[model samples]
Target: MLRYTLMRLGIFAGCLVVVWGAVYSGIFPRGFGASNGLWVLLLALVLSAPISWVVLRKERDRASVQIVTKVDRMKANLDANRSQEDVADDSARTQGQPS
Candidate 1:
């Protein structure tokens, strides 16, 4: 849980850095002064940030499903191997018994 939290924080910081850089570069032109452009940029961020968050959430969910699938496959393989060992053990025990 702590790892996940740290990872999320890192992702947020990286995103903020990228967004700040883009806005500071004056990529979006406004007829008025920089203040108006900054306002527009902030508004766009407020609006689009949720959309970006939702998209990232979806990606995280997909990655989670893949991880779960891999884990389940590993568990199933382990179970099968255990059962085979049990069968072998049982065979050996019976073979040693009196005829």
Candidate 2:
């Protein structure tokens, strides 16, 4: 997960830099003034999404599998603990009753 997150952030930063350079270099029309910054941000977001989706598919899948495995292990541990407690309770109740 950490790796995937870092990669995604890196991709976003790269896209932002590219967009910023393009806008500043006059490749894109510059008459929007304050809105030029907004345009750059929007362009970066749009460009980054598809790139990340294509480039990070494997990392995303690995992270998802890890999460699912961790959840399953925790659930098994909880079930085992509950079963032990139930057995202990039953034994204690039986001992208290007259033979």
TM-scores for every predicted model: 0.50, 0.83
- What tens-digit string does per-residue lDDT give for candidate 2 at 29-98? 6647679878988888999999999999999999999999999999999999999999999999999999
lDDT of each: 0.67, 0.93
Over 4 Å off in model 2, which ranges? 29-33
Native-vs-model 1 lDDT?
0.67
Clashes of each: 0, 0
Off by over 4 Å in 1: 1-53
lDDT of 1 by residue, 1-99 (tens): 344445555655565555666656876454367576565546555655565566567566766787899999999999999999999999999999998
